[model samples]
Target chain A: MVKTNKQKAGNIITALLLIILGAFMFLPIYLTIVMSLKPQEELFIFPPKLYTLRPTLDNFSSMFDILDNNRVPFSRYLFNSIAVTFTVTFSQCVFVSMGAFVLAKCRFPFSKLINSVIVTSLLYQSNVIYIMQYAVMSKMGIIDNPLALILPSIASPMGLFLMKQSISQMPDSIIESAKIDGAGLFRICWQIVIPNQKPALMTLIIFAFQASWNMQGGSLVFQEQYKTLPTVITQISTTGIARAGETMAASVFMLIPPVIVFMLTQSQVIDTMAHSGIKR
Target chain B: MDKLKKLWCDVRKNRDCYLMLAPFMILFVIFTIVPVIMSLPVGFTNFNMAQPPEFVGFDNYINLFLSDKVFTKAIRVTIIFAVITGPVSYMICFLLAWLIDGLPKKLRSIFTLIFYIPSMANVYTVWKIIFSGDMNGWLNSTLIEWGFIQSPVQWLTDSRYVLGVTITVQLWLSLGAGFLALSAGFRNIDRNLYEVAYIEGMDSKLQELVYIVIPSMKPQMLFAGVMQIVSSFTAGTVAQELVGFPSTDYKAHTIMTHAYDYGWVRWEMGYASAICTVLFIAMYVCNKVISRLFKE
Candidate 1:
């Protein structure tokens, strides 16, 4: 690709603009890290210095110190977060892929109906269903249980939709060939379908992980033992003025898993989507 | 009888699919479908947590519209938010995604991460501290130091500034999945078309975007549009997180926050469900209108 001088200048300007834009987008996160590193005394200082003159890990230590005193230790919350998020993401990716496989590859009665139901559910806000969800959870005897969080998230409409969209794009002959080879439905899904739908699966994993990771145990799993890191962070955040650094540290800690998951899987996610035929 | 026979035959033929779908469907029906349907009936009743619900048919809806002043304010605030943030974020997402698409892959991914971190990290609490009401808060301190204000302005607390501040933060976090979707859209555009268009002397970038990029990526554009509308309409968390649950004097009260207040805080589940149903209908209608725009 050859570029004229004007085009080169335009590219440089765009690059500079993007870098500045990136910094602006990231300023809050930068402040969070810097704030978490500041000493408690420095945290409350006037004009709220963006960068600390004297950095310390006291906030991190203090957050752990406080957690050490609780019946459910900090690691328990981390474990809860990890367990819930991983289970939800893994199960969701599997179930949605299965559902997507069925919808995409197999013709069945009510398949279109089921797909519409799922898409319609997406259009409606979840807040509308809060009371009933509570009632349902109570009836299911899962209130204050981690299952309350895990169950609802595992069959997310978005996950199902993404998988279905991706799966529908796959050539039908792959599944037909497997079927002719006397492959069972489950065998075909495991070997042929899931392997090909990696991009959508990755997308589902990211979304599901994020939703579970950020589950504020407000009504469903608010019990101390069942609560995830974000629940604890929200509780601490209300008292944010007094313990700003601790809250910031907790927020950053709570955020690490999703960011890590995203960084690791994002390239595969993009690459697969590139090949998934955007249009027929 | 005929339809049932046909359905049975179809079910038998696709029994394996039914088996595959059962796990997700059972959970989905129990959690998503049942709860949403239950809300429809529950919205007609007075169901405080203490007592069994008493059916009161449309009273909650009427009261919400005619009697609740704050509900009216919430609707206005929500519209103001959706009208501004929805389109702005959609356009910004497209523009940034387009620009990032032009970059090298390594740089593109890094840029994507930077733009995406706020929403991914759930960093609203960090913003809460930055916009803290105290004089020592970052925004307040910076403004005072610059002599922009004689006194510290309460970014979160003061009613006048609350809406503006919330909107700003919402816009910050808005470049999320929709941005990624659009970026993927740009990445997936066929390079052959671009080469062909260039060979034909269709050299202007903006023209290329209009003729080649958007038209080719209609599905992605529609997907991103739906995402933006859903997100914008349901944007209660930023206000609830940054500003208090019910911000000072209801300045930043959005319908979702109102639903949250009634659903959780007051435990007036029926009334809250009514509020939510209204929001659902509004979103559904908007979605329909938006979907119409994309129809061939």
Candidate 2:
């Protein structure tokens, strides 16, 4: 009876602790949702009300109106974001899987060197190279074009590493048997490799998509037509404190897609990480 | 002639593999490798996108080290932020993952999402709202209602509090990939090992964790450690994003912000590159130490 009581007390303590941590973690998100729904007058109130009895979509509607009035419509930025994200994600998945397959399956001269180089590149600070990236992008005339974002993202070494880790875990006999059947490298990659790597591929898609979505474009794509959704959100939000409501709404919109992608792929991602375990 | 023929034969034998790797290597070399190489030389030049670069050897590095007061402050702030956030968040991730590991799958995933959402929803506006300096701000409003304070505190602006506030936000956001990795690490631990440890008189959960769990999760821990270090060092943006750029008297200035100030704002490419080089070296050295510590 005493042991049962102790266990019950422990369970309650654990539950209480988790609930508190969860609430703390969810605070900013909760605030964002409430602030977005707030009417303008309620936004500036002292000892602010956490919830409003009368909520409105006025902020979002106004933000959309403002975006619609810009030289490049708000829809263009959204479309650009979706297009750039999908293009980069799809292309990177294909290229990374191919490169990863070569590294994982084939025995070749200088393969170790190549693998180490790819790994080391993960540690290299890309912020340091943003200037050069811009310089090259300008020289190549890809500036002010969405391809500037897509093309650079295709070279993502992390994607290649992730795919490489996934592919290396495959049994050697599968490839050997495929080779016995006279299946070419492309055939094996498409028919066997990619089909089996769905989890890694899903994780890669979420990562690439989120990264492309968050891309700032820096000085590369300066044209209003080419700017992505995040660029537009930051620009509008940074204007002033008066449009705090609209900024909250914009943040909510920006937050949705990644959350949706995560919800869809999180189980697969967790599975991949479990197996991968940060192993080289 | 013989060597050339041998090389050609080797290449021909691996034609399919080379063919598969072609597209990625081409883009990687052009966009990644070349750009990194180009950035190095820019450290030695005085180029402001408006004019051609002039070779100026070590002046940027010298000025940054000797005369830049803000640069020193940036270093101090960055180190403080890194030292606090890196280990605290890492331990938090590990501990929470341990606690949550025994929960039912549905509940576990829900908790994970709740914890992970902060990182995903890292919008500047949300933080701005939460840490706003007015009485209407969430923190201030709560504090006032509770009578903890008589007036609103400048959480974001006041240098005394900015670093702490930024660190808190950073710790919230720091439950990122490392957290996910550690959670998965805990889940993947062999259940039988715990049973065996228990039978062998591992009396406390602490003993089990120290003896079996941590040792077994070394790779994940190392990966998480290196990642935490890397993430913390580059986390200059959070302060800038949250507290407004160049936060009051440069209190929240970090190495990354310092670099950004020079590189983007001041248009001093050479000096900025030097700052970045220092940051890169710092990250590299820390990574080396972590890898060594985790070496079996």
lDDT tens readout by residue for model 2, B75-150: 9989988999998998888877777776777788788778877877756677777788887778888998999999
Give the Å shift of residue B134 in candidate 1: 4.3
Report lDDT per candidate. Answer: 0.82, 0.79
lDDT of 2: 0.79
Top TM-score model: 1
Best model number under DockQ: 1
TM-score (C-alpha) between model 1 and the true structure = 0.91
Stretches of candidate 2 off by over 4 Å are A1-14, A104-107, A126-128, A165-200, A222-225, A239-241, A267-280, B1-12, B98-101, B182-222
Question: Which 10 consecutive residues of model 2 chain B have the lowest summed lDDT?
Answer: B181-190
Model 1 spans > 4 angstroms off: A104-107, A126-128, A169-197, A221-227, A235-238, A273-280, B190-202
- Which digits, one per residue and each the tens of the lDDT, describe model 2 over residues A1-280? 1346655776788788889988988888888888889998888777788797699999889888877878988889889999998898889988988998999889876678888777666677746587777778888989888788889998788778766765665668888889999999999898887666665566567668778888887566788888888877766665345788898888787789988887776565344333432322
Candidate topping lDDT: 1
Residues A1-280 of candidate 1 have per-residue lDDT tens digits of: 7888878888998888898888889999999899889888887778777789998888888888877676788889889888988999889888888888898778778998998788779877856476678888899899988898898889888778766755665668877878899999999998877775564566567778888889877778767888887777666554556677888787777778888898777677555434644333
Question: In terms of docking quality, how is candidate 2 classified?
Answer: acceptable
